[model samples]
Target: MGVIYLVRHGQAPMHAYSTDPVPADAPGLTDLGVEQARRTGLELARQVPAFTAAVSGGLARQVATCAGVLAAFGEVHDGPLPEHVVDPGWDEYLIPALPGGPTPDMYRSPAAYQQVLDAALLRWTAGAADSDETYAEYQERTSAAVDRAVELAGSGQTVLAVSSAGTITALIARLWGVPAQAWPTLARAMVNASYTKLLVGRRGITVVSMNEHAHLSAADVGLATFR
Candidate 1:
């Protein structure tokens, strides 16, 4: 059996919504985010010192987080570490633009924006909203990305993949036979820099653990964040 570690990238600055069409570059991890990734690496090194493969979503945050983990791991372990590769398939699903865009007031309140986002996601996953990348298409892409990790971790090896909360939740929900409608419940709870372990064996993929964040809390409770 092989183990697949799905690590959610650390916190990134939330994108502010506006009527202006100027495209913003995808945000990278914050200072706290960087530290969280380092702490996660410290714990991973102690538990599993080596990985057969390390993959990351093409997003800047995911790439940075993957590097942070590997760098911190190298600090403690003198052994070889897997080369990191970019896999756009593991990227977070593109959130559809809200109708008329969000108002200035909505942007001011994180809670308000979250409420709007939650509704939009619910509609998207339920097939009630139109998007360039349908929810089903997202599932296919993420599954393929995970299969790549499984392939790399063949036999007794272990693989690590850095991704976003939504991507990780989507895979876990599917593996656990949870319906798409309930994805928000799991997605909302994903802590930054946390990892979920999946076992790939003869029977098939099975979720061994979900959202392990003890490493963050052990270092500092404040490091555990969800966004």
Candidate 2:
């Protein structure tokens, strides 16, 4: 049997939804985000010392988180690490700049920003986003990426993939047979640097866990983060 781990990337500025200066699409991990990734790596090294493959979405935050996890894992385990693969297919769905949407003042309030983001996501999933990729296309891209990872893990090996909350939760929601409209609930619940586990064998891929973040809290209670 083989296993696959889906890790959500650590937090980025995501200034698109706020007044921060960073560009949402190009920002990297925050300092706390780096720590979260390191802790997640240590936990993975303890749980599974050997990995068959390590992958990340091509985004800056995802790539950084993957490197951090592998670096931490390498510190404790005296084994050769797998070369990291960059897969754009696993990238998060685009968050378009909403026109005539929330004002800059609205971005100042976390509650207001969340409300707008959630509503915008709902519309995006319904094929209303201004972006070129539809929800169906996004799903197809992520699903294909997952298939590639599972194939890489083939038989008694484990694969680790670092991705964004939106991409990870979308895949999980589909596997759980949940409607796409409810995807935001799962995405919102995902913690930064959290991992979801899947078992692959004769019975096919089965979700063993979702959003496992005890490692973060174990390291530091304040490290538990959803944004």
Candidate 3:
């Protein structure tokens, strides 16, 4: 048996002209985003002992968040715990065909953009969208990555993985057996840098907690942006 901690990346830069056509792999974290990661890392260090290992999506934000958290742990332990492993399978689902890319002027309001993104996410998760990564493909990749992390944890070891809201939501939906159409509810409620804990045993993975953010104060509780 092992425990797996799935953490969503810290806030990202959200601005009118923020959307750049960079490869999904290289989007950088914003200043506030870095602060969010640092706060999350500090909190986790105070709560958890040494984990077996840590993993993260290769995205810059994910990697930065993982590093921030690890650095916090080092502040106490004063030593590196373990090297981080990068797995693209754990990356967020990308909807290249979405009506418009991430930009300020595309949608009249944040609510409208969210609605459009949500619909696209639902369609992507339900295998109704055509993209480089389908919903089914995402499921297989993320699930496999989690299973592998569990295997690596073995016993008496915790595995921490930093991912995105979409990936985390998809995993939760799979765990709760929720349909793709209901993902909007999950996405809407997911918080940046929030965490979900899972315990994996012979039977399977059991969710111990979802979207835990006790470490964050009320002021920290809100949508975080870098730009």
Candidate 4:
């Protein structure tokens, strides 16, 4: 058996919604986000010392987080960081745009955006999403990515995969047989730069931990944001 670690990318710049058409998949990490990734890497290096390899999702934020964490690990540990690659299969489920391109200012509160996101998910699950992929498609992609990660890990090797909140949570939900309705709620709780661990055995993957961020101290509270 081997271990697979799924990491949520650090906080991104431009988290607030903008009326202007944001470039798809363009956002990367903020300064604080970079530090978060670095801290996470140092923590992981302390915990797991060695990994077979690492992989990252296609998004800039995900790849940047992967690089930051691995770089920090290399600096703290004796060996150079292993080469990592990008796989779009671990990309987050893209929520369809609302009928009107509404900005955060359009909503009464940030929580209201969750309603919009849920509505978008309803459409996605129904195969009526505006984006190229439906929710079902997202499940398929993320599941495949995880299977590939397990294969990459091989016998007793620990491998890491950096991805978005949706991808990480979806994989956990699917692995643990959590109900579909519970997915979004679980995803919402995933802290940025946090990680979930699983033991990949001949039978299948088994969860060791989920959405852990113990490296972030009380003083790092500002870096412990969800958005």
Q: Which residue pairs show backbone clashes in model 2?
A: none
- State each model's C-alpha RMSD to the native: 2.8, 3.0, 3.3, 3.0
Please give, for residues 22-121, the per-residue lDDT of candidate 4 as tens digits: 6666557888889889988988988887878899988778999999999888888887567888999987765434332235553446487677776666
Q: How many steric clashes between backbone atoms does each model show?
A: 0, 0, 3, 0
Candidate 2 per-residue lDDT over residues 1-227, each given as its tens digit: 99999999987655523434654555478889999999999989999979889999987889999999999999999989999999999998655443223555664576776687788778877777566687778888999999998898799999999999989989888888988889988888899999999998887789999999998877545798877
Better of 2 and 3 by lDDT: 2
lDDT of candidates 1 onward, in order: 0.82, 0.84, 0.73, 0.79
Error of 1 at 164 (Å): 0.6
Position 118, candidate 1: lDDT = 80
- Candidate 2 accuracy as lDDT: 0.84
Q: Is candidate 1 or candidate 3 better by lDDT?
A: 1
Best by lDDT: 2
For each candidate in turn, the TM-score is 0.89, 0.89, 0.85, 0.88
> What TM-score quantifies how close candidate 2 is to the native fold?
0.89
Residue-level lDDT for 67 in candidate 2: 96
The local distance difference test score of model 4 is 0.79
lDDT of 3 by residue, 1-49 (tens): 7888888888765431244466655546766667777777777777777
